[model samples]
Target: MAIEIKNTQENFWSSDFGKEYTDRNSRDTRDWDKFYLDTYGVTKTTINEKILGNLPKDAKILEVGCNTGMQLVGLQKMGFTNLYGVELQPYAVEQAKKYTQNINIIQGSGFELPFKDNYFDLVCTNGVLIHIAPENHHGFMSEIVRCSKKYITGFEYFIEGDVESVNYRGNEGFLWKADFCSIYKKTFPNLDVIQKDFYPYITDKNLIDCMFLLEKK
Candidate 1:
């Protein structure tokens, strides 16, 4: 018999088994925040500076999992206004709105974003791709392509497995199977993979694996 994953008020925006796993591990969100700030948070800001350098000023950017508007601060310094964020965490969405201006922080899922097609000049996220379920990876990636008018950047775990496990300090979960780069290439054939890397921006020195920067065709 197939094990069923039911949605609930706790994990309203998640897919099958997501609610149970996410709720079963409430500290995951807190640890997730810490991991980013520790690993690749500052590096990500520097990388985006180089990648987005000399791009059109006032480029509209959308962040798929903008937790509390941290990256928006970096983009603001980069002279890219017109920022938007979609987050599953209700608290994170609310806090994000408090810090940023002209930001559209929506409480929505990445798999089904509440935005029009091709609506942004750039779409980016840090440590977001691994959280989504394997079956839903295609849809989420397609949505990013559909909404992006210029570029897409993503940072995620690069482990190879039909189903892999990710451990954040004490929090752990099964990572839905999907290749980080393949999904982008397969979904948006026109887009070019501009940058890719794996490094230790974390305390453990091996927590984060994959990072990508793609330009729209």
Candidate 2:
């Protein structure tokens, strides 16, 4: 039997709302490329090349909350062979398997990742952290840190100040933005920053997205 999800955010993402999100975001590789280009002023390929190009092609990498596995597919295209993903919703998991080849995409929660500690060379989340409630942020970060053997990375909505909740699709209490990199560093003293950069939204320069890589020190 699967583990029970008790958290409100987890319950929210694992329900019909999550299925709708999957349906809305599911797109071809070309569309994804265009999306990154339009939103971040760069392609996913370019972002991957910048952040991950130096790592070995066979590095063990896992993506937390990898909806539909498009990020894994992009990594595969860049010649990375060992890739894995964990997603919450079964519907998203099904979509991921159909979209990816030779990649392991499992249905699991980020809060209780079903993996051995220090198993992955790099564990990452993209646009997943912002949805976590502030009260659960520490536990969530701890799990990601526990699974990462060498590096932890995040690409998320960023605010320079304290955590700020934002309404999503007109719903409150489901989304937030903060200085996520700083949070990780403060929460886990052993982590050291490798790379950190902010990309402004194309339409609104004041709105920012961030990507950072943290190494175990």
lDDT by residue for model 1 (1-217), tens = 2212222322533443433433443333346445556766655556666667767878888998776666666677677778888777665655565566776777776767678888998888766777666666677788888889888987676755454765543545434324587677776789888878665555665455666789888
What C-alpha RMSD separates each model from the true structure?
Answer: 6.2, 0.9
Give the TM-scores of the predictions, in the order they appear: 0.74, 0.98
How many residue pairs collide in each prediction? 1, 0
How far in Å is the alpha carbon of 124 misplaced in model 1? Answer: 1.4
Q: What's the residue-level lDDT of 161 in candidate 2?
A: 82
lDDT of 1 at 167: 54
lDDT of 2 by residue, 13-51 (tens): 988999999999988899999999988889978877878
Q: Judging by TM-score against the true structure, name the best candidate.
A: 2
| List of clashing residue pairs for candidate 2 | none
Local error of candidate 2 at 128, Å?
0.2
Residue pairs with colliding backbones in model 1 are 39-201
- Return the lDDT, model 1, position 94: 58
| Candidate maximizing lDDT | 2
Q: What is the C-alpha lDDT of each candidate?
A: 0.67, 0.92
